[model samples]
Target: MPNQPKTPVKGFRIPVDLYDAALAKAQSEGRTLTDVVREALHRYIDAD
Candidate 1:
């Protein structure tokens, strides 16, 4: 996706617990939080 932002997105607000969970999941998978979140959002959008 060449159109993806070159920098990390900032200032988005989500629950601390949710953030922690996503962080842990990303770490355990050896991936970035952004990658994890992006995949999640993709899945969610495609789910319907």
Candidate 2:
């Protein structure tokens, strides 16, 4: 079979509690919230 193209990734907004947790984790990790979230997502996608 031919290789299929990857679809564009979609983003969703965080709820308050999760957003706060991510912000806290980001601060403690010395990273920006965006970086923290991106890193988390990268891990999630790579897990499988």
Residue-by-residue lDDT tens digits, candidate 1, 1-48: 569669855778999999999899889999989878788889999999
- For the record, the alpha-carbon RMSD of candidate 1 to the native fold, in angstroms, is 3.3
Off by over 4 Å in 1: 1-10
Tell me how far the alpha carbon of residue 22 in candidate 1 is from the true structure, in angstroms, after superposition: 1.5
Q: Using alpha carbons, what is the TM-score of model 1?
A: 0.65
Q: Model 2, which residues run further than 4 Å from truth?
A: 1-11
By summed lDDT, the worst window of 10 consecutive residues in model 2 runs over 1-10
Weakest lDDT window of 10 consecutive positions for candidate 1 = 1-10
Per-residue C-alpha lDDT of model 2 across residues 1-48, encoded as one tens digit per residue: 149576566778769998898789889988888667677889999999
- In order, the Cα lDDT scores of the candidates are 0.86, 0.79
Candidate 2 residue pairs that clash: none
Candidate 1 lDDT score relative to the true structure: 0.86
